[model samples]
Target chain A: MISVLRRELLAFFTSAAGYVLMAVFPVAMGLLALFVFPAVLERGASWFHTKELTMRSFFLAFPWVAAAVMPAIAMRSWAEEYRGNTFQLLLTLPAPSWRLVAGKYLASVAVLCLMLLTTGVFPVMIAANGGWEGGPIFGGYLGCLLLGSGYLAIGMFASSLTSNQLGAYMAALLACGTLTALGSFAGLAGSSGALSSMVRFMAAGDHFNLLAAGYLKLETVTFFISMAAFFLMLTALGVEGRRYR
Target chain B: MLNVEAISRSYGRFLALNGLSFSIGKGAILGFVGPNGAGKTTAMSIITGLLAADSGAVHLGDDEVHATPSLVKSRIGFLPETPPLYTAMEVSEYLRFCGEARGMDRQQLGERLENVLANTGLSARRNMPISTLSRGYRQRAGLAQALLHDPDLLVLDEPTSGLDPAQILDMHELLRGLAAQGKIVIFSTHILSEVEAIASHILIINHGRCLAFGERSALLGADGKERGLTDLFISLVKKRNP
Candidate 1:
């Protein structure tokens, strides 16, 4: 597993894709947080004009940003192996299937962590502006990591389903986007019913919202972990299916 | 000894390997030859435990590869035609990954790494990225990774498919050297001359069934008959088609 992780990390860092993604992710998050989300939620007021020194704009815009960036980070995980003919080599290795899945998943998560870390400038800027409490900032970063893990897992599972990276990216984008979109519809389902509650629980945004609000519920943590584990297991099964075929 | 028994596999309506069976002992080079899509790669995959046989078993000595794939895979080395290589990695880095993936200890991996690099004539290029190497060197690096664990059975699917004459000769010599080291080497190719040059055992197949299997000498000329592999192969294809 460590071997797979090391090789994957080496491959990622050496390729232009890593640098491009690192550069693009923060720019995209910045545009969406300061420009796009504020335009949508505040009727043309930018985050700076909100009169608050909080990272609420950034936290709120993260799920949408993650829906794109996480899939980009993970789209090549298994698809490239298949295209390069290395999937057969991986299958023939003595390591268990789950280890390979975990290795690839962890490598993507490591990159995600770095991408998130780059966004630390958001909080630092907010701090240097006037100063705000650290609790929500910390919770928001934690929520971003957890939410990104779910997106990465979904992307990895999508990658295992196809050899074409573009197809994997599209599938993951659709899946992650749908799950994120669910959060926007929870209020329209009439606010106080089993259906609305079910939608809220199933959507990743609700849990992330709690963490971003400085409320660390155990169920919120469990939801993200379960989401990651579920998709990772599915990725392993996809790999194992090739052997039986 | 490597023993394959009644192995069969199918893909949708196409039966890829139909009750194929053959075996060879240590120090033997088994040349697997057949027409395109004759289940050569499929059979090799099954033998190495990379793919499952629908209704058969492959046993390397006492362990059934199908039942205990992880255990058996550690003792088998496989190189497919394209060579599953991470082109960004250096040759040594890739070999180290293969060794560690097979659960080799650091000390053992260190020793094997030196030997594999030397055996594959890749010692000088150990630090070079795989993407920068020529095709011949890439194939050598692939072989080096497969040999990193000192596996008992080495299964190569068309290892010399696209090599130049000089590279082909080098590959033949390498296979001979591995066979001399008491390892079982099974390689697939369409070149009959290559089989003639190195193999001690031969298995010929077409349309997912074995056409012939035996010692190269006995199969080439027996029952007071003598023929080259080409003549035998042509006659066999003719007999099957006509």
Candidate 2:
């Protein structure tokens, strides 16, 4: 299992996919936070207000970006093996199925972390410019990590469902979109009370929003962890089902 | 040693193996000869625990193959019809990953990798990416991965399929060497000439059933009624059809 993990990690670092994700993701977020949101970027903005805007901007853009990028990292996880018939060789190994799944999952999560770390530039810029609250920035980074993990799990599950890479990408995008849309203004306006609460709880964006605001609710943490576990377990089950069928 | 009893598997409406049963003693090469879609690959997949059978059981010595598949799998090596190469990886790195996955320790893995690379004639190409290799080298790399752990049972699906004549001869000599080393090597192929050149025992399968199972000489016949293995195979398949 350790060897498998090391191999995956090595491959991620060596491949262009890893470098592109690590380099592009935070820079994109940085550009959006510093330049695109005029409401947040204009002069006379206090440090607290600027940091708050940065956090909001990151939270707002994370879902759409992750929904697009995480799938590219995960879609080839098992689908490429099926395409080249390497899956047979993998299954024949003495290691249990869960080991392979977990190894790949951890490697992808590490790459996501590399992507998330790029956003450190934003906090550095704020600190250099003026006084800002470190608490919210810390909480916001944590929220992004958890959110990215959840999306990756979903993408891994989708990838396991098909040998076609495009199908995996599309399935992951659709699933992530549904989760994001449920938290939007359009989603809340159409529902009320308990239905609204249920929708919010199920939406990843809703939990991320709370975390971005510096609220560490147990329910939100549990929701993200449970969501990640659920999708990873499904990915394992999907791969197992292929052997019998 | 291996034992299979009444193993049947289906893919929805298609019956791939119907109550198929066979057993081989330790260190014996059993050639599985069949026409296209004769369930040869399916049977090997179940035996290697890569696939599951709908009914029946597979046994590796005293252990049930399906119930305790990991234990059975640790002792076996498999090469599927298509060589399962990760084209992005270098040959040496791929073999190391395969060796460790089969439960080899670092020292043992290093020694084994060296041996397999030497035996499979893959030493010169060890640093090259799999995608850059020729068809013959890719096939050799596939065989090397299967042989990395010095497995007790080698299940090869068309080990020499898609090779040129020279490569085929090399594969024949390689299998012979493996069998001579007291390793049980089972392979499936449609080429009778390959079988005649290398196999000591043969199992002729047609339409998911074992049509003939015995020594090559007995199946080919004697007493001035000598016929080539291809003629014998064709006759057995024809007899089953009629």
Candidate 3:
């Protein structure tokens, strides 16, 4: 598993893909925070009457960006192997299917983390302006990581279903979009308060909303972790199921 | 020894293997020959435990491969028809990945990597990315990967498909040497002369059925006359399904 992880990392870094991804991720975030949204970017001194910088807007924009970028990041995970016919070589190796899935997932997550880390200077730049609330800033970054992980897991599951990279990318985007949309926006349709509440509880964005607000809650953390694990398990089982069919 | 019994696989409506069976002992080079869609790759996939048979079993010693696939897989090395190369990876880098994936310890890999590269005629191209390699060199890289594991059974599908004449001859010598060292080598090829020159046993398959499975002499005519694999294949592969 470690070897697979190492190879996956090497594969990303040795190619143009990694450098492009790393640069794009933070560059997009920086653009969104500093330039894209005039309402937030030009919200005169002290960020809409508070001393804190406009990081809330960045956290809000990050998930949407992640939803799009993560699919591209993970689209090649299994899809490339399937396309190149290397699944035969990979599946026959003396390792469990879960190990391969986990290795790839971890490598991709690490790439996202590398991107996230580069954006750390964003908060630092914001802090340089004074009045930095550490809790909300920490929570904002945490929420983005959790949300990115959830999206990436879904992306890997999407990749497992097809050999075409574009198909994998679309499948992942469609799945993540629909699931997150349904979970987050289902309340708009339902007249019943209980049903709406249940949907809100189920929605990934709802939990991220809480975390980004600096409300540290166990349920939200567990929800994000389980979402990531569930999709990863799906990918592993998918790989293993190939042998039977 | 390797044994495949009653192995059958059907993909949707197409039956790829139909009760196919064959066996070979160690220190033998088994040549697998058939036309394009004759279940050769399917059989190889089954034997390597990469694909499951709908009905039937493969055994290495007393362990049924379906039951203990992980254990059996450790002792087998496979090179599929497409030459599973990582396009982004250099030849040496890919071989290192293969060796480590097979659980070759650092020292063992160090000891064997050079030899495997040398034997596959890939020493000169070790640093080149597989995507940049010529067809013949890519095939050699694939062969290099299979040999890296140093398995008890080596299953290769069309191992000499893209090689030039000299490279094909080098492959023949490599297989012979491996067999002499007691590794069971099973390879499929379209070249009849390649099989005639190297394989000690021939397993002729057609339409997912085993037409002939025997030593070189056992596949000879009733008068015990000498014949090439091409003639035997032509005579044995019945045109109409029986």
Fraction of native contacts (fnat) of each candidate: 0.91, 0.89, 0.76
Worst 10 residues of 1 chain A by lDDT: A126-135
- Clashing residue pairs in candidate 2 (N, C-alpha, C atoms within 3 angstroms): none
Off by over 4 Å in 1: A187-194
Among residues 3 or more apart in sequence or in different chains, the pairs in candidate 3 whose N, CA or C atoms overlap within 3 Å are: none
Off by over 4 Å in 3: A35-54, A191-198, B239-242
TM-score of the second chain, cand. 2: 0.95
- DockQ-wise, the better of 1 and 3 is 1
For residue B188, give model 1's deviation from the true position in Å.
0.7
Q: Write the per-residue lDDT of candidate 3 for residues B132-227, one digit (tens) a residue.
A: 999989988988888887889999999888888888888888899999999999999888888888888998888899988898777855347877
Error of 1 at B230 (Å): 1.5
Could you estimate the TM-score for every candidate?
Answer: 0.96, 0.94, 0.94
What's the distance in Å from true for residue B101, model 1?
A: 2.1
Q: Write the per-residue lDDT of candidate 3 for residues A105-150, one digit (tens) a residue.
A: 9998888888889898878877787847788788878988888899
Each candidate's interface RMSD, rounded to one decimal?
Answer: 1.0, 1.1, 1.0
Tell me, by lDDT, which candidate is best: 1
